[model samples]
Target: MFGRDWTEKDQSVIEHHDYSYIVYKSFLKYLYTGVISLPMQELLELLDLAIVYCETKLERCCIQEIKRGISIQNIDFLRSIADKHKKEDLKIFCLCLESRNS
Candidate 1:
């Protein structure tokens, strides 16, 4: 993790930004406990955080979300994330979709 001092950020901005309270707590829990309960509604963002934290094991729990019941926009996001993370299975999934579309 890049050590920029996140604590000095203005409270109002932190509160209103895309980082929700629940996600914030989860991140803190991950920092302290190395474990977290994934709330269903926040799975996608949580997966992104997991990737950022190098928590690949935690990220796998939501891989199915990246693989199914998705809109094109989200599929694109997932593909980008997979590419960033070098997640081979996600790359294969996107490749299968590309082959289907062609």
Candidate 2:
């Protein structure tokens, strides 16, 4: 954000203290190579970062990975995350999986 009225416009160095170094590095790698490699926890954080940065392609990739790792044990957790993030596709997928399992 180097444009007018941006927070980082007048700053020389921008800092993002939210994510860990590893997670941020992984996100940068994905940005450059279009490949994502991270554990489930970090992957979820990366999804949040993708959404924040408006990286739709990366966001979709994270969603796909999350779907692949979904299980009955974690369906409720995933549903809650989907609801929190307003990810309708993920919410619907969780609902379908729950219905099938039920």
Best by lDDT: 2
Clashing residue pairs found in predicted model 1: none
**TM-scores of all predicted structures:** 0.52, 0.86
TM-score of 1: 0.52
Off by over 4 Å in 2: 2-13
Question: TM-score of model 2 relative to the true fold?
Answer: 0.86
* After superposition, candidate 1 runs with Cα above 4 Å error: 1-19, 24-42
Candidate 2 overall Cα lDDT vs. reference? 0.91
Task: State the weakest 10-residue window (summed lDDT) of model 1.
Answer: 8-17
Task: Provide the lowest-lDDT 10-residue window in model 2.
Answer: 35-44
Candidate 2, residue 11: how far the Cα is off, in Å: 6.3
Q: Can you write out model 2's per-residue Cα lDDT over 1-102, one digit (the tens) per residue?
A: 899899899999899899988889999999889988888889889999989999999999999999998999888998898998899999999999999999
